[model samples]
Target: MPLTLLPTRASYGPGDPIGIELRGDPPAAAELSVWRLGELVHRQPLLAGAQQTLPELPAGGYGIELEAAGGTVARTAIEVTTDVRARLRYGFVASYRPGKDAAAVADFARRLHLNGIQFYDWAYRHADLLGGGEQYDDALGQPITLDSVRALVASLRAVGTASYGYAAVYAVGPEEWPAWQQHALLRPSGEPYALGDFLFIVDPAAPEWLEHFRDDLAASVAAVGFDGFHLDQYGYPKHAATLDGTPVDVAESFLTMLAGVRDRLPDARLIFNNVNDFPTWSSASAAQDAVYIEPWKPVLTLGALAEVATRARAASNGQPVVLAAYQHVYDQAPAEASDRATAFTMATLLSHGATQLLAGEHGKLLVDPYYVRNHEAEPRTLEFLTRWYDFAVEHDALLLDPAIVEVTASYVGDYNDDLDVAYQEVEVAEAAVPGTVWRRVTRAGDGLVVHLINLVGQGDALWDAPRNPLGKTGPGELRLKFVRGRMPRVRVADPDGRPRLEDVEVRIDGDHAVAILPALDIWQVVHVAL
Candidate 1:
């Protein structure tokens, strides 16, 4: 007989002791290891016919493995809630076969820490939406079973992850384009506005067309059990002509559609794509669950990345910000280049309080439209990803604090010195780091938090470009004007998933507090207790 471990509950809160019951004809001795995000936390001998209690742990997903004399036998997953303040980590999937992806769900939850997903192209047709029967092939000609989609959604929900179905608000497939042609947006030349050879843009403002979408959305929820809808739109036809030769404002149309959905599917989650900066026009709507944006050109460079995300967050009115900044790594570029790009982009986004909407199941890079292609990440790159994700989970409080504000001062660094704010009472000195240094100051719980991003040696200011940048080799000096009597404590933390708290010696220069940070990497957070 095989040894088995049964967990009392599917999920456990941080600080809660997990209860497990072992059974079956086990070996003389066996070891049970409680691993949190791939790191072993607790290990103990497994006693047959005995109920065991795993020690309390920080909030995160954990895996319990039973290793016998022969090899590992049974495994289970448990989630511990630590801090839920950060925005949901989101990802995507284009092709999800039924019996497959189901078993791999926990891997995504435990590894990437993802709590939401964009079920990209999982529907039958762009126009018909969920009208496809139980079995159909997607636009990419990949076979997909509607039953499998529901199964996947159920499996994700079981792990506390929600699935959002992908649907184009205005796009209709060519096969269904004939009957809907009357509702299609027309061009100034009196021709229908066709997105591609096989798709046409429908008029969202058209009463009947709008009703069609609303009805289809509700039907999709009923049919596939999609928790919400991933509403998409082409970044075009900003201004266009309707079938009746009336001027159509795309932004207003989108807003109207969202409001309508809120009225209809009041409980459904809605995530609209603010293609580029379309949010500037329609972000004020109350129907969106989070502000989603796909950054385009003119917003290249690290500073620009921070600014764009900040701008979107400002417009979101406290809603979470998700960036669909896809990384075109793997098969396309060198492994080193891919690693550098991933580190830089992820660090920049998270440091600015934004969540990323990339990656997919099975450690695959989401590059193609179908999402069927599997681009495996290099071993070292995968390690970096796991560490970064775990770091985000651990430091969600300071990095994801919605109330924190970005302060501009000369003390931070050069690129961050907006308005050329000259130093007066406070001064931050730079080490001999190779790249450009940028810093963001925020007010964290009873402390001043400073985030450092290293852009040095990265030639192209473009966020997607691949290049190697050296990490800071020495400490960066900081001097602040402190009115407090004694030296203040300083803490430096990186996304290496390691707990690091060091008190830097603070020298009293009149009424100022001066401290030094050991080093900075792709990203680092410095907390100065008040």
Candidate 2:
């Protein structure tokens, strides 16, 4: 029998004792170790199959492990925060089909540690958001019910998770064309711009279109009680026109439409998808909670992911960024290959300070634009994701703290300064080199976090393609100047490894300090505390 441990809730607030469900070959004579950063802050005995509550912890990320008498360890990460939104872990709930359990959906999301959920494709029509009184087919001919939507909202909210209903910002079906034609966004040939035959594009900032959508949104809120809306786009028509031949700059219109929306619905949260970055620069400063990007062609590599995440965060003035980068390759790849690719995607996005929409609709994951077409996640994938998510939650501050600024260019490589990773003669660049270790450097206060992603075995850089296991890059060293003589206290962390975090010994030279780097596998973050 294998030992298993899971937290009862995604997070706990101040003064709340931590609870865990321990079973499945319960440990005999176990000791719990509670660690914060590189320090072991708390430790105590834990009993198997017992209703035990660990003492309340401070507001920060924690790594807890219970070592059984036989030396087996059942481990999990814990977050103690005043608000669940601090980390902003995101997920999706797309199933509104009959017989789908709302409570179960919420539970799955909680386990994923998602504080917000995009209720993907939970509407009858993109234009008429709330239809199908009890239950009816959606725009794509899938079962959906208003009752199911409301129940999901209530259930998710009960767990500290927000629910956002999905709606296309400027889309209407052919049946709605007559009412919205005057505001239609037309192509150069004078034909309406549409996504195939299903959704016709319209000027999002059109006065009439705004008013109509506003009413539909307001009504949806009154009925289903969602926290907000996820406004989507078909990612085209960068230049278009209204039916009356008025020229339109699609990117510029987002600000006007979003501003008007904020003015009308001041309390409603808004999240917009800048698909393939069709118009992110202008929309990033718009009134939205996070910068959401749905990457397709051209924006496919890990280096590109870093660029997008960095630029989006800067453009949004430090807003949350999420990559809706689906993994359709899972359809053709074997289970091991898919998991490896997923791990690569996680390393690329999360290490770049953005989250990925990896899970959705219960046990499924989004593999395509159509949320309903999600693939059932393999048990291996789920287990892998859960551990990575645990690692992410444990040190989100080091990874996403707005104060942490990139110093990769300034301090590493051909630099304004010198911070070098001692890899073999192979070229090491800030942007990952195929068959080389990718090093990204960042600093906040006296601490510097260097992310090392092993790209040593790959020939291609597509983030969604199948990945080969990392090549062994044995113990190396990170050498940097010791200006101001800030003594180093270095700690390394990896989600896929035992003892999630371990302190590494540092050596000091006359003018520099070197921290030993353990053999690289998937991804590792080294925090040099000064």
- In candidate 2, position 363 carries an lDDT of 67
- lDDT (C-alpha, whole model) for all candidates: 0.69, 0.80
Per-residue accuracy of model 2 over 1-530 as CA lDDT, tens digit each: 56666666667788866887675766566888787775788888876455457888879888777777676477777788885544567788877876679887776766677778899888778888766676888887888877788888888887667888888889999777888888888888888999999889999999888888888888888988989888888888888978677899988777788887777778888888999886888898887788889988788888888788888878866778888989987897987888888888888878778889878657688888988778998888888887888788777777766667888878876445467787764456677678888888888667888888888889977788888877888886888777574676778888887445578888887677888778887888888776
Report the CA-based lDDT of candidate 1 relative to the real structure: 0.69
Candidate 1 clashes between residue pairs 3 or more apart in a chain or in different chains: 435-456, 436-456
Instruction: Tell me the lDDT of model 1 at 254.
Output: 85
Q: Residue-wise lDDT of candidate 1 within 325-388, one digit each (tens)?
A: 7776555788788777777778778878887776766566765444566566666776677667
Segments in model 2 whose C-alpha atoms lie over 4 Å from true places: 13-17, 23-25, 47-51, 83-86, 413-418, 483-486
**TM match of model 2 to true structure:** 0.94
